[model samples]
Structure formats: structure tokens, C-alpha cells
Target: MGTTLHPLNPSDANLIQARLSELGYYRYQPEGIWGLVSRSALQDFKAANGLSADDVWDGSVEASLRQARPTPASDTPFGEWSVVGFACSAEMNPRKMVVSAKGIVVGSMICDMQGPLARSSADWSGSVLCHIDGRDIASKISLRVSGQRLVDRSVIGTSTIVPTSFDRCS
Candidate 1:
């Protein structure tokens, strides 16, 4: 979007990386450096869109990218998600989740299930039957993919518990 032109500086490179990532060609987080990863992503985008693979960023690429639509989180093949959440001081280790392109959600490495994807004006989510304190309650859960290292989960499972994020699992 900037008029800085090709041979983009770090700031422009960062912007390009962010855009490319949104288009699903870049995997790593935007670091504001025009490195190999950035160039590769750009090249891939060009090839996909039938642009000349000159290994350079220019107005044509920018224009096409600007017109491109972002892929939904539900469509992306998510990574191996794990969390050691604490339930009443007991560490709930091995709690995991993974979403595939076929709409299958594998979780805790023990759960192989898929729930209907529900969309609202606020966000995208699906319901998973959670067994909390002995009752299986259908709970709302959202999974968001970002960069390379993280896929965030926001659980609006029950009114009794606050929406929980399990992103800091080590």
C-alpha cells in the first residue's frame, strides 16, 4: 500500500509478509526483514496468480494481493495443538487439539471428533462436548491460527467459567 516501491525496506517488507501470510503463502511471523522466507512467499504468490516470477515485489503483485481475499481460519489445516490446562489444581496434561482440512478435529490425542462449525457476527466457532465435573456440556470453542508457532483457542464453553485461552501451554 505504501508508495515506497520495490526493493522494499523493512517496514514495507513487514507489511508484505503480513499480507502474504493472510493469503496463506507465508508461514513464519512477520519480522520486518526481507529475508528468504519473504521472497519465497512473494514468488509463490506470483506463480499462483500467473505473474512473472521475477523475485521482486512490485505494483502488480501489490494490486493482486490487495484484491485477494483472506482464507478463513476454519479452512486452514491447523497444527498440533496441546495445552496442560489446570483444573482445580490438577494439571490436565495431554490436552490437545488439531484440525485438518477435512473438518476432522483430533484432540488431547484422544479425541477424534468433528463438530459443526458455527459462525456469528462476532467470530467463527464450533461446539465440542466438554465433560466438566461429570456432565457433558456442549460448549462453544474458537480456534485462531497465527504465524507459525501458535494457534490460539478461546473457550466460551460455559457461563459459569470465564472464556479461557490456552495459548501459553509449555
Candidate 2:
């Protein structure tokens, strides 16, 4: 198993810890690191989320974090932007999956993660329903651009990654 816990930034750790806490796995200060508190928190999170009792980060584990409902931002942009690329790394593991999409900013991008079959979790995927400037993007299927690879675009700040299949809409 290539699972290793990396030191998380204070803010990132706080966010992760907070998320875990919200899911009823409280056990950390949200300082964001592999300290005793975080480790315990991870253990709790794993058990609650139906993951291995071991404190390791796998796709399913990370998905639980990512699937947490996000606080609605003041400005949400939900529409066809076009799936360009997607990249993700398991929280405990350093490896990442980069998915590239066609350069078309469609309505929404949905992703269904086919996690390792060994893990006992549904292959999770859904569309990001963004609310931008009071407009609803609703849902749209995402298209794979150039396979799983990084793209020149940035997936941070004001971007929502929804996991939907790549199917054209009317």
C-alpha cells in the first residue's frame, strides 16, 4: 500500500479536520498535520465513512472529504464551462489522478470515480450545481479531454468540479 500521511498546511488541515468533525469524527485541533490529534481524527473519520480502520488515505477516503457539502459562495457560476482536466490525490497518499477533458466549457462537469474495487464504496460521481450571479447551471455531463492528465487551466478559486458523465445536452 502506497499510503503515507503528509504534513498538511494549517488551513488545509483545519478544513479537513472541520469536515471530519462535521461528519461526527471529532478528534483534532484543525492545525492540519499528522500529529496525534489528526491521526486520531483520521481514524475516526475512516471508521465513520466505512473505510478501513487503519488511518490511511485512499480514493474512497478522499472522496468522503471532497463529497462534503460546500458552503455556498456569494458568487456561484454554474453553467457550461467545458471539462478541461481534473486532478486529485488521496489525502493520505501522495499519488494523484489528473483527468483531462475537451476544451469546452459546458454547463457542468461531473466525475464518477471508479475507486479501486477493493474498497466497499459506490463509485461516486456527480455534477457540480453552481449558482453564479443568481443563475443556476443545474447539471451537465462532463467530457474527458485528454485522459487523466494535468491541464494548463487552474481548478481552484471560483471553479466547481461536478462529477457527471460526458453526454451532450440540447
Instruction: Pick the TM-score winner.
Output: 1
TM-score per prediction, in order, is 0.39, 0.33
Q: Cα RMSDs of all predictions?
A: 11.7, 15.5
Collision count of model 2:
27
How far out, in Å, is residue 135 in model 2?
66
Kindly provide the TM-score of model 2 when superposed on the true structure, using C-alpha atoms: 0.33
Candidate 2 lDDT tens digits, 17-43 = 777655534433456555665655565
Q: In model 2, which runs have C-alpha deviations exceeding 4 angstroms?
A: 1-7, 68-170
Query: Which pairs clash in the backbone of model 1?
Result: 96-108
Q: Which digits, one per residue and each the tens of the lDDT, describe model 1 over residues 1-170? A: 44344435777778888887776666678878887767766655664455654466667777777774633222332333454343322344444444432232333322212443443432345555655455555655565434333344545344633333433221
What candidate 1 gets wrong by more than 4 Å, as runs, is 1-7, 70-170
Please list the C-alpha lDDT of all candidates, in the order they appear. 0.50, 0.37
